[model samples]
Target: MAEVSNKQVIFKDYISGFPTDADMYITTSTISLKVPEGSKAVLVKNLYLSCDPYMRPRMTYTTDSYVDSFKPGSVIEGYGVAKVLDSGHPNFSKGDLVWGFTSWEEYSLITSTEMLIKIPTTDVPLSYYTGILGMPGLTAYAGFYEICTPKKGEYVYVSAASGAVGQLVGQFAKLLGCYVVGSAGSKEKVDLLKNKFGFDEAFNYKEETDLVACLKRYFPEGIDIYFDNVGGKMLDAVLLNMRVHGRIAACGMISQYNLDKLEGVCNLINIIIKQVRMQGFVITSYYHLYPKYLEMVLPHIKEGKIVYVEDTVEGLESAPQALIGLFSGRNVGKQVVVVARE
Candidate 1:
């Protein structure tokens, strides 16, 4: 190992409204990558980190959010899959592959060993842990199964359907015998959702003049479940077309992430009239159900029933652009960054 340390991405300051790549930047540091002797921490070489929409909230200094914001001047922390190179903790040994919250850098000294879960299977690509097999997958599973509670033959709609979580949610809905439709930002994403991810129907939201009318046309009987990814206008439109007793799983709101003033939905009364139940969630709260999710999803992946899409960036240097692309619908699939290799 080199005596000098490596470069890491740091938050420049507390952001307001929307976040841009300029809000964060990469910097060099000389702090030792390894944990000090006798310290109950493991030193890890980060391989891949996931870029998600939720990370946007963490960039702001907000105490009301589900999680605390990332401190300015410090390395931004997010979900990363890494390989342990050294450890003073008994639970982990050198060479162990794991995934958890790690600083966006080549190496990170992870103090919370409990948060890091051992990679039990190497049969699949290790990078899967940064996406399909990690937090995104779990979020899709929990949101669909636990929140949406779809029944056979029901109608399901997924917004931003070609994304990391949206793709999985669509496939999972199909497996449960539901009529699933999805909306994406472009023709390419629409085709991926329909032809690749096996969604029943998909359309480019950009091409559609009125979202509510689009939903009404596709879902003639109205949507039984709505897996919302892009909030604001899309969500407002969805509420107008939802069937009686419809369930909405509020997975993300990428559409409103960058706006200075949030959009207001004009159809708030629809929720009460239709008995629509909308709920927002954080995946970390459902970590206890991970094994259950894996048991259900792993078989589908192995049997080739489940399909995942990802747009990967090469190094930590490209992470800022990759993450910023989420708000603009620039990323075609799950955005991930390769930080290092074992």
Candidate 2:
């Protein structure tokens, strides 16, 4: 077996509040190209890495999250597109392309192969395996259809609308003939939501002082479906503007992830008064729906009925900053870091 240089992003330490590039460091190491004998590990050369909001919680010393925290002085693990180099696992082979839980490095020896899935085809951009064709795509599909239970001509509202899951949710609602509105952090993101994703309307959430009143203005008849990506005041505001028997899919709470103490929502009473349903879901629970989602989305993508946007940065060296940018809304769309061209 041959050994090769592997460049990696190391988590320097557990963090509190917002994460910066300083929280991680770049380093080089060596790894054998072959998987060890009698092990079920798969060795891969990483091609692309995903930057997602859920990763923020893993940076803390301890978190009440579905995933484990990133270890200090160790590699940051995430979903990535990779080519199999060697494998002791029967399911994978040399040269096979896959996407799943991989380290932020040029190469990885992954033992937890449960999340790993072979890339079905390369007809679409391989980078898409880190976004639209991967986790975020399934998240939007399951959250909207299964959780929200949307209907035609219903009023839909999405928060953090230009981010990975939100963008797809807005588009999915529109395709179902629902009247969709979304809220993003910047004017540029707002424009992309309305023009690129085909939402009926989009607004910049940062400019709104009274979020409750702002929601009322956009959704006069009240929102029937709410995709809550950013929690805190925005969720409280939306609760007050939800129609009777409304459904809310709480995919994430990006706004509270960085805070030491989370903000409170003062509208719990509204849930009872409006008779609404709100559910918080982890995408891992919905991975079983991938094949069905792919069949439904692929034709729409090929025909230009569905579109995806990526804000890409190059190289393993850029991974830290690219990930940190997701919290500050520094990225325009789905944030992807290109580790290697192949």
Candidate 3:
């Protein structure tokens, strides 16, 4: 078989503070399209790549982290959807669509199929696997239902509400009959939260002079469940406004991820005062519930009861800019890099 040119986005070095497009560079390398015999690996043609905030942590070199940091001068890896070109694995075959951890390249040879999930429904856009039907969707489902344990009619708040994970959380809250509010960085995102995602209320945090006062205005009755996405001042404010026995699902701390010095929250007293249950979670821990999540969400999607938005940029060349844009809140919804049509 003839070798194919593989274009990839490679991490240049360990990043500090916010990452720039310079932190990653695109390069081309040649690879054989076929998986070697007895390799037990699947070769896939990447279709869509997900730009997630969690990837920022992988850019930094850390001694203690749940996930390993990306190697310098290696392809940056993240969640993506692909079509199997060749496979030595029993579960995957040619033309099968799958989503999981894959490199930032036109093609990837995925050896570890343990986490890879074959796409069962192609009725929805295949790109949805990178967000709603994949990692972000699972994160929202596990964090909200398993951790938050929300009650109907309860007040819920989601930070970074227009983001991949936050948008889904707000929609799920609405579906569960909870009164939901979301906070985003810009007016456009705030508008999306209310008009598009069905949040009860949405606000631009950048416009608020005092976050504490802002939370009070939105939740006069106090927040019964808080899906904390952007930590820092927003978390401190939410602490002061949580109702008795409120639950907090600590998801991503996007605001603090790129900072050289992590921001500290001074509201532990509120946790004790309200007897709140606060928990931090990584989505991989809840993979066992993925089947249940699909069963519940797939129908809602097919019925038009749930909606998803995506910000797509064409080609692997746009991956760096798309990844960097997350820090500035440039994306309106889930940021996706379309690598190939098939």
Candidate 4:
């Protein structure tokens, strides 16, 4: 392996309110792109890093959360696709591409070989691993199939519909013969949902003043399943329009990410009245189903039954803005940062 100065993104401090790029700083250090001899670790050159909403929680050092925050002054870590430059592990050989948690840097030494899954199919773009074929994909799969459990011809609604995970959930529901409607922050995103994703209907939530009324207009029969990505008001609105025995899969809450205080959910009684089942799950908890998720989504992707959209920012230097863009709805699709080329 070659010696190089690794350029990496560092967490400066615990974040508050909406985070700015100033909170993160890029720094460099001298390093060799190889794992030391006799160590069962793999050193990799990172290709793409995924920018996700949950990562905001990780920016703040919180002990109450299921996942720990990124340590201040350390390299920030996230899901990324990388090419192993050198390996001392039996599971991975040199030059193999894999995806897992990795630092936002040019290269990384990964000891958790178990978390890194070798990319079996390279016919698709390698960056797909950052979103559609990685954590976000698994989140969509698990949230839709396992949590919502939709029946054919059921009415389905997804908030933040044009997002990486939300878009997939909408399409999956449509594939299951369900009537799907999605709400996006912008008209462009709403158009993408209807035209590109083949959703039954889509609306710009920003334009809708009465969310409950808007939902009722679209779902006259009531919603059978809700794929919730933006919680708070959206979740409150959906609760009023949910059908009896409906299911809610809480995938994320991008709307609540920047708030100084988490918003309170207003309608708990609706859950009991409608016998609604609302479950919150972390992708890590359902990792055992990843192979099953792969089996289901990979074919759809290969056959063009499913389509993926990504907003790629060139260079690791743009990583800070790309991640912060998620909360502002500035990103049109799955936000990813290109750290280095293969």
Residue 155 lDDT (model 2): 100
lDDT of 3 by residue, 205-315 (tens): 999999999999999999999999988889999999999999999998899998899999999899999999999999999999999999999999999988999999999
Instruction: Give the residue spans of candidate 2 off by over 4 A.
Output: none
Measured with C-alpha atoms, the lDDT of residue 334 in candidate 1 is 91
RMSD in Å for all candidates: 1.5, 0.8, 0.7, 1.1
TM-score of each candidate structure, all chains considered together: 0.96, 0.99, 0.99, 0.98
Q: Which ten residues in a row have the lowest lDDT in candidate 2?
A: 57-66
TM-score-superior candidate, 2 or 4:
2
> Weakest 10 consecutive residues, lDDT, candidate 4?
29-38
Report, for every candidate in turn, its global Cα lDDT versus the true structure. 0.89, 0.94, 0.94, 0.92
- Over 4 Å off in model 4, which ranges? none
Q: Write the per-residue lDDT of candidate 4 for residues 201-265, one digit (tens) a residue.
A: 99999999999999999999999999999899999999999999999998888888888899988
| Candidate 3 local lDDT, residue 46 | 95
- Global Cα lDDT for candidate 4: 0.92
Full candidate order by TM-score, most accurate first = 3, 2, 4, 1
lDDT of each residue in 1-342, candidate 1, tens digit only: 455577899888987776787899999886575679799999988899999888888887789988789899989888989998888999899999998888898888999777788888887778888878899999999999999989999999999899889999999999999999999989899999989999999999999889889999999999999999989999999999999999999989888876778899888799999999999988988999988888887788888999787898999999988888887889998988988756
Error of 3 at 168 (Å): 1.1
User: Which residue pairs overlap in candidate 1's backbone?
Assistant: none
